[model samples]
Target: MTGLLIGAIIISFSSVMVRLANVPPDVAGFYRLFVGGLGMGLFLWRMGKLKHFTLHIWAWALLSALFFVGDFFYWHRAIGLVGPGMATMLANFQVIVLAVVSVLILRERPTAAFMLAIPMALAGLYLMVGVSWADFTPDYRVGVVYGLLTALFYALYLLSLKFSLSKAGADPLAMACAVALLTGVLLGGLSLGQGESFAIPDVRSLLALATLALICHAVGWFLITRSVQMVRTSLVGLILLLQPTLSFVWDILFFDKPVNGLEIAGVILALVGIYLGSLKGKRGK
Candidate 1:
């Protein structure tokens, strides 16, 4: 439980760091993953587990990394366009996307709880964005679209990671390193293609990106994975609810973003819906 809270708190800073970097989303994502992969690679090598990456694990890890890159790319864009809180909350829709994918590909039937959650989640979204349609700008709509795209790509990442884990054999460390390295390379290439400068313009940007990589990516994720092994699955799911909620708070506190009553209600409804959907997924399994 402590690990989960720590992880969530650390991850809550991800958007804050990205925003502070003041770089293109692709560039920020690239540097964050690259630095993170470098540090993780060194740690794993020092632990004598660097050579454990088998062909099978590498194959799936590469595939997983591709989706991960897409996830982060759109996620960062969403954050820049809409603000961290809305973007983070929108990205949680990946659970719904995953449920749909399972129904189509895995032939898993959706439970009644999931069916009910569908409307609840949509209602929350309507309250979050659709209510602002009278004053919505093109950029705002684009951000919302990117947020959904982030969720889609994130669902793909989750599915690919699951496959990679099954094929990773005994060396989870190696698999993780391979995925991170590949994701970094892919995002780096993307940044170059977009003609974004990779050089940090100032020390402040450098510090933010470094913190994003080391603390948010490496430390936070490590804690989340460790907690998963120690805590009950249901509790873990519930604890994860804190991440987006705290992200919202961070945006308000750090960025001076204003919140409305409707937005607060939307957050509550979205969380309730997500909880129900996840519970149904567990029961279905």
Candidate 2:
């Protein structure tokens, strides 16, 4: 639980790090995955487990990487447009998306609490932006769309990753490393196609990107993956919420994001809904 808490805190700084790097979205995504993947590969090599991945694992990792490419592309753009707080919060709409997918495709029945959470979350979003959405600029509207797209892609990534982990003898670390490296390659190609530079601008930007790669992607994810299974599922859901919550706080503190009373209420309501949506109810005997 401590590890989970610490991991969440570490990841909460990811948005700020991206902003500090101030690079093109694809550039930031490429470095984050490439550097983080290298770190994980080194760790696995040290443990004598780097060469053990099966072809099946590699295939699944490739699929997961595709989804993650979409995830980072939209998410980073949203962060640049909407400010980190709202962007992070909007991306977390993945919980709701996952819930809906479980119900529709997996043929699972949602709990009463989960059913109730859906409308509450929508209401929260309405409060956050729908009230004066037309008054906002087109770029801001596009950012919101990108944020929602991030949620969709993130949900797909989670589903693919879950399936990958279910394979026999699948090492989570190795799978993560594969996905990160592959995604980095894809993002790098995309960056080049878009004419984005690969060079780091300054020492501060370099440090920020490096910390984002090693700390948030490598250390933070490792901690969460290691500690999550040991904790209660419900508790894990709640604890993981800290990432988005702290991200919102960091945006306000670091970027001085403008907020109103309605927006605060919306954030609270949305978070509560996300938490409720993440919980699994007991099956009947």
Largest TM-score belongs to which candidate?
2
lDDT at residue 24 of model 2 (Cα atoms): 96
Q: Once superposed on the true structure, which residue ranges of model 1 sit more than 4 Å away at CA?
A: 280-285
CA RMSD (A), model 1 = 2.0
- TM-score for every candidate vs. truth? 0.93, 0.96
Stretches of candidate 2 off by over 4 Å are 282-285
- Index of the highest-lDDT prediction: 2
Residues 1-285 of candidate 1: C-alpha lDDT, one tens digit per residue: 898889988988888899999889988888778787777777677778766766777787898899999899999999999999889999988877777776667877777777887789889888888898778789988999999899899889989888778866646556767888889899999989988888898999989999999988777876776577688756776888787888889999999988899988988888777766665353245
The residue pairs in collision within model 2 are none
Among all windows of ten consecutive residues in candidate 1, which has the lowest summed lDDT? 276-285
Total colliding residue pairs, candidate 1 = 0
Which residue pairs in model 1 clash with each other?
Answer: none
